[model samples]
Target chain A: DTAVSQTPKYLVTQMGNDKSIKCEQNLGHDTMYWYKQDSKKFLKIMFSYNNKELIINETVPNRFSPKSPDKAHLNLHINSLELGDSAVYFCASSWTGATNEKLFFGSGTQLSVL
Target chain B: GESVGLHLPTLSVQEGDNSIINCAYSNSASDYFIWYKQESGKGPQFIIDIRSNMDKRQGQRVTVLLNKTVKHLSLQIAATQPGDSAVYFCAETYHLIYNQGGKLIFGQGTELSVKP
Candidate 1:
Protein backbone atom coordinates (compact mmCIF):
# COMPACT_ATOMS: atom_id res chain seq x y z
CA ASP A 1 0.00 0.00 0.00
CA THR A 2 1.20 3.51 -0.71
CA ALA A 3 2.08 5.19 2.54
CA VAL A 4 1.43 8.70 1.30
CA SER A 5 -0.58 9.54 -1.77
CA GLN A 6 -1.63 12.74 -3.56
CA THR A 7 -4.10 13.07 -6.36
CA PRO A 8 -3.62 14.83 -9.73
CA LYS A 9 -0.02 13.95 -10.46
CA TYR A 10 0.05 16.82 -12.94
CA LEU A 11 -1.95 20.03 -13.08
CA VAL A 12 -1.99 22.66 -15.82
CA THR A 13 -4.15 25.75 -15.42
CA GLN A 14 -4.28 29.34 -16.51
CA MET A 15 -3.42 32.23 -14.28
CA GLY A 16 -6.18 33.40 -11.88
CA ASN A 17 -7.70 29.93 -11.90
CA ASP A 18 -8.18 28.21 -8.57
CA LYS A 19 -7.23 24.60 -7.93
CA SER A 20 -7.01 22.12 -5.11
CA ILE A 21 -4.75 19.14 -4.39
CA LYS A 22 -5.65 16.33 -2.07
CA CYS A 23 -3.23 14.41 0.16
CA GLU A 24 -3.77 11.36 2.32
CA GLN A 25 -1.50 9.17 4.38
CA ASN A 26 -2.09 5.70 5.76
CA LEU A 27 1.00 5.67 7.92
CA GLY A 28 -1.04 6.60 10.99
CA HIS A 29 1.29 9.49 11.65
CA ASP A 30 0.35 12.40 13.84
CA THR A 31 2.06 15.13 11.85
CA MET A 32 1.71 16.11 8.19
CA TYR A 33 3.41 18.76 6.04
CA TRP A 34 3.19 20.49 2.66
CA TYR A 35 6.32 21.48 0.78
CA LYS A 36 6.92 23.24 -2.50
CA GLN A 37 9.80 22.51 -4.88
CA ASP A 38 10.68 25.23 -7.37
CA SER A 39 12.31 24.98 -10.80
CA LYS A 40 15.71 25.02 -9.17
CA LYS A 41 14.75 21.92 -7.14
CA PHE A 42 14.82 23.88 -3.93
CA LEU A 43 12.32 22.41 -1.48
CA LYS A 44 10.70 24.74 1.02
CA ILE A 45 8.16 24.00 3.71
CA MET A 46 4.86 25.82 3.27
CA PHE A 47 2.64 24.50 6.04
CA SER A 48 2.43 21.78 8.65
CA TYR A 49 -0.31 20.27 10.81
CA ASN A 50 0.03 18.15 13.88
CA ASN A 51 -3.05 16.27 14.95
CA LYS A 52 -5.25 18.67 12.98
CA GLU A 53 -3.65 21.75 14.48
CA LEU A 54 -1.76 24.29 12.41
CA ILE A 55 1.86 24.21 13.47
CA ILE A 56 4.03 25.79 10.81
CA ASN A 57 3.03 28.50 8.38
CA GLU A 58 5.76 29.96 6.17
CA THR A 59 5.79 33.31 4.37
CA VAL A 60 3.63 31.98 1.57
CA PRO A 61 1.08 34.18 -0.15
CA ASN A 62 -2.53 34.45 1.02
CA ARG A 63 -3.67 32.56 -2.06
CA PHE A 64 -2.32 29.37 -0.53
CA SER A 65 -4.37 27.76 2.20
CA PRO A 66 -4.11 24.34 3.81
CA LYS A 67 -6.90 22.47 5.54
CA SER A 68 -6.62 19.29 7.52
CA PRO A 69 -9.94 17.65 8.17
CA ASP A 70 -8.21 14.95 10.16
CA LYS A 71 -4.75 13.69 10.92
CA ALA A 72 -4.78 11.33 7.96
CA HIS A 73 -5.79 14.00 5.41
CA LEU A 74 -4.30 17.37 4.55
CA ASN A 75 -5.57 19.20 1.52
CA LEU A 76 -4.14 22.27 -0.21
CA HIS A 77 -6.40 24.92 -1.77
CA ILE A 78 -5.02 27.67 -3.94
CA ASN A 79 -7.15 30.73 -4.66
CA SER A 80 -6.54 32.86 -7.76
CA LEU A 81 -3.30 31.15 -8.53
CA GLU A 82 -0.56 33.18 -10.18
CA LEU A 83 2.21 32.32 -12.57
CA GLY A 84 4.64 32.16 -9.68
CA ASP A 85 2.63 29.27 -8.25
CA SER A 86 4.11 26.92 -10.79
CA ALA A 87 5.99 24.32 -8.83
CA VAL A 88 5.88 20.76 -7.53
CA TYR A 89 3.95 20.29 -4.33
CA PHE A 90 4.75 17.47 -1.95
CA CYS A 91 2.97 15.93 1.00
CA ALA A 92 4.80 14.34 3.91
CA SER A 93 3.99 12.64 7.19
CA SER A 94 5.86 11.67 10.32
CA TRP A 95 5.11 9.67 13.41
CA THR A 96 5.44 12.78 15.47
CA GLY A 97 6.30 16.41 15.13
CA ALA A 98 9.79 15.89 16.53
CA THR A 99 12.79 16.86 14.43
CA ASN A 100 14.40 13.47 14.92
CA GLU A 101 11.54 11.64 13.24
CA LYS A 102 11.96 10.76 9.59
CA LEU A 103 9.29 11.96 7.16
CA PHE A 104 7.62 9.81 4.54
CA PHE A 105 6.80 11.79 1.40
CA GLY A 106 4.27 11.27 -1.35
CA SER A 107 5.11 11.16 -5.05
CA GLY A 108 4.18 14.86 -5.48
CA THR A 109 1.88 16.93 -7.69
CA GLN A 110 3.32 19.08 -10.48
CA LEU A 111 1.45 22.37 -10.90
CA SER A 112 1.94 24.64 -13.88
CA VAL A 113 0.20 27.99 -14.10
CA LEU A 114 0.16 29.53 -17.55
CA GLY B 1 18.58 34.67 7.07
CA GLU B 2 20.10 31.35 8.03
CA SER B 3 20.26 28.77 5.24
CA VAL B 4 21.80 25.47 4.27
CA GLY B 5 23.75 25.40 1.00
CA LEU B 6 25.82 22.95 -0.98
CA HIS B 7 29.32 23.37 -2.31
CA LEU B 8 28.61 21.94 -5.76
CA PRO B 9 25.45 21.91 -7.78
CA THR B 10 26.32 18.76 -9.70
CA LEU B 11 28.77 15.88 -9.42
CA SER B 12 29.55 13.14 -11.94
CA VAL B 13 31.19 9.91 -10.89
CA GLN B 14 31.89 6.55 -12.50
CA GLU B 15 30.11 3.48 -11.27
CA GLY B 16 31.78 1.79 -8.30
CA ASP B 17 33.50 5.05 -7.38
CA ASN B 18 32.96 6.86 -4.10
CA SER B 19 31.01 10.12 -4.02
CA ILE B 20 30.95 12.88 -1.45
CA ILE B 21 28.46 15.80 -1.33
CA ASN B 22 29.24 18.73 0.94
CA CYS B 23 26.81 21.11 2.66
CA ALA B 24 27.30 24.20 4.82
CA TYR B 25 24.77 25.53 7.31
CA SER B 26 24.77 28.96 8.88
CA ASN B 27 22.64 28.17 11.92
CA SER B 28 24.77 27.05 14.82
CA ALA B 29 21.69 26.20 16.84
CA SER B 30 20.68 23.42 14.46
CA ASP B 31 21.09 20.19 16.38
CA TYR B 32 19.54 17.69 14.00
CA PHE B 33 20.44 16.99 10.37
CA ILE B 34 19.03 14.70 7.72
CA TRP B 35 19.90 13.64 4.16
CA TYR B 36 17.23 13.07 1.53
CA LYS B 37 17.45 11.59 -1.95
CA GLN B 38 15.10 12.79 -4.67
CA GLU B 39 14.76 11.05 -7.99
CA SER B 40 13.36 12.52 -11.17
CA GLY B 41 9.59 13.04 -11.01
CA LYS B 42 9.45 11.95 -7.38
CA GLY B 43 9.41 13.42 -3.95
CA PRO B 44 12.34 13.53 -1.55
CA GLN B 45 13.03 10.31 0.38
CA PHE B 46 14.83 10.01 3.65
CA ILE B 47 18.30 8.47 3.33
CA ILE B 48 19.95 8.95 6.71
CA ASP B 49 20.27 11.37 9.58
CA ILE B 50 22.70 12.48 12.29
CA ARG B 51 22.32 14.55 15.41
CA SER B 52 24.49 17.32 16.81
CA ASN B 53 25.70 15.03 19.55
CA MET B 54 27.19 12.59 17.08
CA ASP B 55 29.95 13.26 14.57
CA LYS B 56 29.17 10.45 12.14
CA ARG B 57 26.41 7.99 11.29
CA GLN B 58 26.49 5.12 8.85
CA GLY B 59 23.71 3.55 6.82
CA GLN B 60 23.73 0.74 4.27
CA ARG B 61 25.79 2.52 1.59
CA VAL B 62 25.64 6.10 2.88
CA THR B 63 27.53 7.89 5.64
CA VAL B 64 26.83 11.30 7.16
CA LEU B 65 29.56 13.37 8.82
CA LEU B 66 28.94 16.47 10.87
CA ASN B 67 31.35 19.19 12.01
CA LYS B 68 29.93 21.37 14.69
CA THR B 69 32.80 23.88 14.70
CA VAL B 70 32.29 24.88 11.09
CA LYS B 71 28.60 23.95 10.95
CA HIS B 72 29.29 21.66 8.00
CA LEU B 73 27.81 18.34 6.98
CA SER B 74 28.60 15.81 4.29
CA LEU B 75 27.10 12.67 2.77
CA GLN B 76 29.44 10.01 1.38
CA ILE B 77 28.21 7.27 -0.90
CA ALA B 78 30.13 4.06 -1.30
CA ALA B 79 30.41 2.21 -4.62
CA THR B 80 28.11 4.53 -6.51
CA GLN B 81 25.65 2.83 -8.82
CA PRO B 82 23.37 3.98 -11.60
CA GLY B 83 20.40 3.67 -9.26
CA ASP B 84 22.13 6.22 -7.05
CA SER B 85 21.80 8.93 -9.63
CA ALA B 86 19.57 11.54 -7.98
CA VAL B 87 19.58 14.95 -6.35
CA TYR B 88 20.75 14.84 -2.73
CA PHE B 89 19.57 17.41 -0.23
CA CYS B 90 20.79 18.19 3.26
CA ALA B 91 18.37 19.55 5.83
CA GLU B 92 18.96 21.09 9.23
CA THR B 93 16.31 21.07 11.93
CA TYR B 94 15.91 23.55 14.70
CA HIS B 95 13.44 22.74 17.42
CA LEU B 96 10.80 25.32 18.20
CA ILE B 97 10.26 25.91 21.87
CA TYR B 98 6.71 27.12 21.54
CA ASN B 99 5.75 24.61 18.87
CA GLN B 100 6.02 20.86 19.06
CA GLY B 101 7.66 20.43 15.67
CA GLY B 102 10.99 21.57 14.36
CA LYS B 103 11.62 23.73 11.33
CA LEU B 104 13.53 21.87 8.63
CA ILE B 105 15.68 23.99 6.34
CA PHE B 106 16.89 22.33 3.16
CA GLY B 107 19.99 22.99 1.08
CA GLN B 108 20.08 23.93 -2.58
CA GLY B 109 20.75 20.23 -3.40
CA THR B 110 23.51 18.44 -5.34
CA GLU B 111 22.75 16.32 -8.35
CA LEU B 112 24.74 13.08 -8.48
CA SER B 113 25.22 11.39 -11.82
CA VAL B 114 26.74 7.93 -11.91
CA LYS B 115 28.14 6.92 -15.29
CA PRO B 116 28.54 3.26 -16.07
Candidate 2:
Protein backbone atom coordinates (compact mmCIF):
# COMPACT_ATOMS: atom_id res chain seq x y z
CA ASP A 1 0.00 0.00 0.00
CA THR A 2 1.20 3.50 -0.75
CA ALA A 3 1.76 5.21 2.56
CA VAL A 4 1.49 8.70 1.14
CA SER A 5 -0.22 9.65 -2.11
CA GLN A 6 -0.99 12.78 -4.13
CA THR A 7 -3.33 13.22 -7.08
CA PRO A 8 -2.52 14.51 -10.59
CA LYS A 9 1.08 13.47 -10.99
CA TYR A 10 1.50 16.17 -13.63
CA LEU A 11 -0.30 19.48 -13.98
CA VAL A 12 0.05 21.94 -16.86
CA THR A 13 -1.76 25.25 -16.73
CA GLN A 14 -1.56 28.76 -18.15
CA MET A 15 -0.56 31.73 -16.06
CA GLY A 16 -3.32 33.37 -13.98
CA ASN A 17 -5.23 30.07 -13.82
CA ASP A 18 -6.28 28.47 -10.57
CA LYS A 19 -5.42 24.92 -9.56
CA SER A 20 -5.42 22.63 -6.58
CA ILE A 21 -3.39 19.55 -5.54
CA LYS A 22 -4.83 16.90 -3.29
CA CYS A 23 -2.89 14.72 -0.86
CA GLU A 24 -3.76 11.81 1.38
CA GLN A 25 -1.93 9.51 3.78
CA ASN A 26 -2.85 6.11 5.21
CA LEU A 27 0.00 6.01 7.67
CA GLY A 28 -2.21 7.17 10.53
CA HIS A 29 0.06 10.11 11.05
CA ASP A 30 -1.09 13.19 12.87
CA THR A 31 1.20 15.70 11.19
CA MET A 32 1.10 16.39 7.45
CA TYR A 33 3.12 18.94 5.51
CA TRP A 34 3.30 20.55 2.07
CA TYR A 35 6.66 21.27 0.49
CA LYS A 36 7.76 22.92 -2.73
CA GLN A 37 10.85 21.74 -4.57
CA ASP A 38 12.12 24.38 -6.92
CA SER A 39 14.24 23.97 -10.07
CA LYS A 40 17.38 24.00 -7.97
CA LYS A 41 15.93 21.07 -6.01
CA PHE A 42 15.67 23.01 -2.79
CA LEU A 43 12.87 21.68 -0.67
CA LYS A 44 11.04 24.43 1.21
CA ILE A 45 8.18 23.99 3.61
CA MET A 46 5.05 25.92 2.69
CA PHE A 47 2.60 24.74 5.31
CA SER A 48 2.00 22.04 7.88
CA TYR A 49 -1.30 20.73 9.15
CA ASN A 50 -1.62 18.75 12.34
CA ASN A 51 -4.95 17.11 12.94
CA LYS A 52 -6.61 19.48 10.47
CA GLU A 53 -5.17 22.48 12.29
CA LEU A 54 -2.82 24.86 10.51
CA ILE A 55 0.51 24.97 12.32
CA ILE A 56 3.35 26.28 10.25
CA ASN A 57 3.04 28.92 7.57
CA GLU A 58 6.24 29.77 5.76
CA THR A 59 7.06 32.85 3.72
CA VAL A 60 4.84 31.79 0.84
CA PRO A 61 2.70 34.27 -1.04
CA ASN A 62 -0.95 34.73 -0.16
CA ARG A 63 -1.97 33.25 -3.50
CA PHE A 64 -0.93 29.85 -2.21
CA SER A 65 -3.31 28.48 0.39
CA PRO A 66 -3.50 25.07 2.04
CA LYS A 67 -6.69 23.54 3.31
CA SER A 68 -7.12 20.45 5.41
CA PRO A 69 -10.57 18.98 5.35
CA ASP A 70 -9.65 16.23 7.77
CA LYS A 71 -6.75 14.75 9.64
CA ALA A 72 -5.79 12.53 6.71
CA HIS A 73 -6.11 14.99 3.83
CA LEU A 74 -4.46 18.28 2.96
CA ASN A 75 -5.00 20.15 -0.28
CA LEU A 76 -3.21 23.12 -1.77
CA HIS A 77 -5.04 25.79 -3.75
CA ILE A 78 -3.16 28.22 -5.94
CA ASN A 79 -4.80 31.42 -7.15
CA SER A 80 -3.69 33.42 -10.17
CA LEU A 81 -0.58 31.38 -10.61
CA GLU A 82 2.50 32.92 -12.15
CA LEU A 83 5.14 31.39 -14.39
CA GLY A 84 7.49 31.16 -11.43
CA ASP A 85 5.02 28.87 -9.70
CA SER A 86 6.28 25.95 -11.77
CA ALA A 87 7.84 23.35 -9.51
CA VAL A 88 7.32 20.03 -7.75
CA TYR A 89 4.97 19.86 -4.79
CA PHE A 90 5.27 17.10 -2.21
CA CYS A 91 3.09 15.81 0.61
CA ALA A 92 4.61 14.21 3.68
CA SER A 93 3.37 12.61 6.90
CA SER A 94 4.95 11.66 10.16
CA TRP A 95 3.82 9.43 12.99
CA THR A 96 4.34 12.00 15.74
CA GLY A 97 5.33 15.56 16.47
CA ALA A 98 8.68 14.79 18.07
CA THR A 99 11.98 15.59 16.46
CA ASN A 100 12.82 11.93 15.95
CA GLU A 101 9.91 10.81 13.81
CA LYS A 102 10.66 9.79 10.25
CA LEU A 103 8.57 11.23 7.44
CA PHE A 104 6.99 9.41 4.51
CA PHE A 105 6.60 11.39 1.30
CA GLY A 106 4.41 11.03 -1.76
CA SER A 107 5.69 10.76 -5.32
CA GLY A 108 4.91 14.45 -5.91
CA THR A 109 3.02 16.54 -8.47
CA GLN A 110 4.91 18.49 -11.08
CA LEU A 111 3.11 21.77 -11.70
CA SER A 112 4.03 23.72 -14.79
CA VAL A 113 2.77 27.29 -15.05
CA LEU A 114 3.24 28.53 -18.58
CA GLY B 1 17.33 29.74 11.62
CA GLU B 2 18.51 27.76 8.57
CA SER B 3 18.89 24.42 10.28
CA VAL B 4 20.28 22.09 7.62
CA GLY B 5 22.86 22.56 4.85
CA LEU B 6 25.09 20.49 2.56
CA HIS B 7 28.67 21.01 1.54
CA LEU B 8 28.48 19.81 -2.06
CA PRO B 9 25.87 19.95 -4.77
CA THR B 10 27.07 16.80 -6.57
CA LEU B 11 29.14 13.72 -5.93
CA SER B 12 30.36 11.14 -8.46
CA VAL B 13 31.31 7.65 -7.36
CA GLN B 14 32.35 4.46 -9.11
CA GLU B 15 30.35 1.30 -8.93
CA GLY B 16 31.25 -1.00 -6.02
CA ASP B 17 32.84 1.91 -4.18
CA ASN B 18 31.75 3.77 -1.09
CA SER B 19 30.30 7.26 -0.98
CA ILE B 20 30.14 9.92 1.68
CA ILE B 21 27.90 13.00 1.67
CA ASN B 22 28.42 15.83 4.13
CA CYS B 23 26.06 18.34 5.75
CA ALA B 24 26.21 21.23 8.22
CA TYR B 25 23.53 22.53 10.51
CA SER B 26 23.07 25.44 12.92
CA ASN B 27 20.25 24.36 15.23
CA SER B 28 21.78 23.17 18.47
CA ALA B 29 18.31 22.53 19.73
CA SER B 30 17.69 20.06 16.97
CA ASP B 31 17.97 16.54 18.33
CA TYR B 32 17.26 14.42 15.30
CA PHE B 33 18.61 14.22 11.74
CA ILE B 34 17.51 12.27 8.67
CA TRP B 35 18.77 11.67 5.15
CA TYR B 36 16.48 11.43 2.15
CA LYS B 37 17.04 10.36 -1.43
CA GLN B 38 15.09 11.82 -4.35
CA GLU B 39 15.26 10.94 -8.05
CA SER B 40 14.05 12.84 -11.05
CA GLY B 41 10.27 13.03 -11.32
CA LYS B 42 9.90 11.62 -7.81
CA GLY B 43 9.52 12.80 -4.24
CA PRO B 44 12.07 12.39 -1.50
CA GLN B 45 12.55 8.94 0.12
CA PHE B 46 13.65 8.40 3.68
CA ILE B 47 16.96 6.60 4.00
CA ILE B 48 18.01 6.73 7.64
CA ASP B 49 18.06 8.95 10.72
CA ILE B 50 20.11 9.51 13.88
CA ARG B 51 19.28 11.13 17.15
CA SER B 52 21.50 13.62 18.92
CA ASN B 53 22.48 11.20 21.65
CA MET B 54 24.29 8.99 19.18
CA ASP B 55 27.03 10.13 16.88
CA LYS B 56 26.68 7.19 14.52
CA ARG B 57 23.80 5.05 13.28
CA GLN B 58 23.69 2.26 10.73
CA GLY B 59 21.15 0.71 8.41
CA GLN B 60 21.35 -2.00 5.76
CA ARG B 61 24.02 -0.39 3.60
CA VAL B 62 23.93 3.13 5.00
CA THR B 63 25.69 4.71 7.94
CA VAL B 64 25.04 8.19 9.36
CA LEU B 65 27.53 10.08 11.48
CA LEU B 66 26.87 13.18 13.48
CA ASN B 67 29.29 15.63 15.08
CA LYS B 68 27.65 17.94 17.51
CA THR B 69 30.80 19.95 18.15
CA VAL B 70 31.11 21.14 14.59
CA LYS B 71 27.42 20.72 13.92
CA HIS B 72 28.10 18.44 11.01
CA LEU B 73 26.54 15.24 9.67
CA SER B 74 27.57 12.70 7.07
CA LEU B 75 26.06 9.73 5.30
CA GLN B 76 28.26 6.86 4.17
CA ILE B 77 27.05 4.26 1.72
CA ALA B 78 28.85 1.00 1.28
CA ALA B 79 29.41 -0.63 -2.12
CA THR B 80 27.49 2.10 -3.85
CA GLN B 81 25.44 0.85 -6.77
CA PRO B 82 23.77 2.48 -9.75
CA GLY B 83 20.46 2.46 -7.98
CA ASP B 84 21.98 4.77 -5.41
CA SER B 85 22.32 7.54 -7.93
CA ALA B 86 19.96 10.28 -6.83
CA VAL B 87 19.76 13.63 -5.06
CA TYR B 88 20.43 13.10 -1.37
CA PHE B 89 19.21 15.53 1.27
CA CYS B 90 20.06 15.97 4.93
CA ALA B 91 17.15 17.14 7.04
CA GLU B 92 17.13 18.43 10.60
CA THR B 93 14.22 17.88 12.91
CA TYR B 94 13.15 21.23 14.35
CA HIS B 95 10.81 20.89 17.27
CA LEU B 96 8.16 23.57 17.39
CA ILE B 97 5.49 21.88 19.47
CA TYR B 98 4.96 19.19 21.99
CA ASN B 99 3.73 15.66 21.26
CA GLN B 100 4.14 15.98 17.49
CA GLY B 101 6.59 15.43 14.73
CA GLY B 102 8.98 18.31 14.37
CA LYS B 103 9.33 20.16 11.13
CA LEU B 104 12.02 18.99 8.71
CA ILE B 105 14.52 21.51 7.54
CA PHE B 106 16.05 20.20 4.33
CA GLY B 107 19.38 21.26 2.97
CA GLN B 108 20.32 21.88 -0.65
CA GLY B 109 20.36 18.40 -2.15
CA THR B 110 23.49 16.68 -3.39
CA GLU B 111 23.14 14.68 -6.57
CA LEU B 112 24.96 11.35 -6.30
CA SER B 113 25.90 9.53 -9.49
CA VAL B 114 27.32 6.03 -9.42
CA LYS B 115 29.14 5.43 -12.69
CA PRO B 116 29.77 1.93 -13.92
What is candidate 2's CA lDDT for residue A113?
95
- Give the per-residue lDDT of model 2 (tens digit) for A8-96: 99999999999999999998898899999888888998888889888789889999999999989999999999999999999998875
Question: Which candidate achieves the best TM-score against the true structure?
Answer: 1
Q: Which stretches of candidate 1 lie over 4 Å from their true place?
A: B1-8
- Interface RMSD for candidate 2 relative to the native interface: 3.3
Q: A4-45, model 1: which lDDT tens digit per residue?
A: 999889999999999999999999999999999988888999
Most lDDT-accurate candidate: 1
| Clash number for candidate 2 | 6
RMSD of 2: 2.8
Report the number of clashing residue pairs per model.
0, 6
lDDT score, candidate 2, position B116: 98
